[model samples]
Target: DQQVKQNSPSLSVQEGRISILNCDYTNSMFDYFLWYKKYPAEGPTFLISISSIKDKNEDGRFTVFLNKSAKHLSLHIVPSQPGDSAVYFCAARTFSGGGADGLTFGKGTHLIIQP
Candidate 1:
């Protein structure tokens, strides 16, 4: 099954504190990984990504680290802000598709940053 699991349903963090979210996968064929941030009623926006070839990727306030051996990955947001309060989805692309690209998404993790 294409189950990309985000075990936590929500997290609350104070402003200027670090927030971490975790994800796990059951399939071994997955090759590409992505983290997408989403607001209510809007499409999930791509945040960070890493291929099977890389173990870590970072962009400004966001960092995603993948550990293939453990079948897991984590996203870290340093000094989380209220603006960061939103649902985060963990997705993966293992292969191409007919009408869509490789994308299997988790239910999502809600991150709340208190100002």
Candidate 2:
């Protein structure tokens, strides 16, 4: 079964507005979550991330919030611009003793920015 899920396959937002993408996970072992943005023919680039210990993390126009109790996380982009349009993937990883575990990714959500 898919451990991470992005219920909405696509989201459309107006320029200069706020765009919120939601993600849910079934794996309770996940302690770190990351969001990546991908454009056509381009590799996914890391955007924002949040640790399970923190409720929110913000960087410039991007903000990520994690709710460990609910196994939910969200990425918010304020003043959405045309460049913000892309496929966003939510990934989660469980930290082991030392080595890093592979990340579980959700089916990406496409964000469309409209003028």
Candidate 3:
């Protein structure tokens, strides 16, 4: 069974509006959560992250919120721009590997920014 899931395959948002992407996981062993933004063929670039201990983390226009009780997390982008149109993946990993272990990634949600 897939440990992580992104139920929404795609989302459309108007420029200057907010974009929210959702993710869920069933593995309680995961202590670290990360969001990655990817273009057409390039590798995924790190977006934001939040530890299981913290409920939220923000950087610039990007924010990641974690709800350990519900085994869910979400990414919020304020004032969505055309450049933000890309595939976003939610990833999680256990802290046992000292940050060396491979991350379990979701299917990814394709975000489209309406110009």
Instruction: List candidate 2 segments past 4 Å from native.
Output: none
Of candidates 3 and 1, the better by lDDT: 3
lDDT of 1: 0.92
Worst 10 residues of 1 by lDDT: 93-102
lDDT of 3: 0.96
Cα lDDT tens digits, model 3, 1-115, are 9999999999999999999999999999999999999999799999998989999999999999999999999999998999999999999998674455689999999999999
Steric overlap count per candidate: 0, 0, 0
lDDT of 2 by residue, 53-78 (tens): 89999999999999888889999999
- Return the top candidate by TM-score: 2
Query: Roughly what TM-score does model 2 have, to 2 decimal places?
Result: 0.98
Score every model by TM-score.
0.92, 0.98, 0.96
lDDT (tens digit, per residue) of candidate 1 on 1-112: 5479998999999999999999999888888999999999998899999998999999999999999999999999997999999999999877656543669898899999
lDDT of each: 0.92, 0.96, 0.96
